[model samples]
Target: GIQVEQSPPDLILQEGANSTLRCNFSDSVNNLQWFHQNPWGQLINLFYIPSGTKQNGRLSATTVATERYSLLYISSSQTTDSGVYFCAVGRSSNTGKLIFGQGTTLQVKP
Candidate 1:
């Protein structure tokens, strides 16, 4: 079993600001994914960074499997970025079931 934790339980950012979200896991994992749940409760996949770093426009993520942690960086935050960010991990033995951690909720004010 693995445990996950996210920092900055609550965040407030002005529109166009930048923010960094962090996730820490207690054990080794084979799959790691980042998700953003909108105000309407729709979940969108942000990145599947089990290791190394990846960037998609204004969003980027990095995972260090050895250190058991991952990070999501949001550049130029927008009102659209206001939502709950979640980190999910799946073990190799598990059949694609992701264990999610408590999320970090971001509020971007215009």
Candidate 2:
């Protein structure tokens, strides 16, 4: 079994600000993904950084496999970036299931 946990649990930011979120896993994993759930409950896949660093636009992510943790960075934040960020990990045994973290809720204001 695998377990996922996210840090801060909540965040608040102003437009053009920056923030960082974290995720920690309890067991070895085959893969990992970051997601953002909007107000309408639409889940958007943010990253698939299993053991590396990646960036897109104002967002970036890093995963340290040996440390069993992952980080998400948001630069120049906007109101559109306000949502619940989740980290999901896939077990090595191929259960075809992703254990998700509690999520870090972000609120961005003007």
Model 2, 54-100: lDDT tens digits are: 99999999999989999999999999999999999996535368899
Structural similarity to truth (TM-score) of each candidate:
0.96, 0.95
Error of 1 at 43 (Å): 0.2
Give the per-residue lDDT digits (tens) of candidate 1, residues 1-110: 78999998999999999999999999899899999999999999999888999999999999999999999999999999999999999886353889999999999999
List per-prediction Cα lDDT, in the order shown: 0.94, 0.93
lDDT of 2: 0.93
Poorest stretch of ten by lDDT in candidate 1 = 90-99
Where in model 2 is the C-alpha error above 4 Å?
Answer: 92-95
Clashing pairs in 1: none
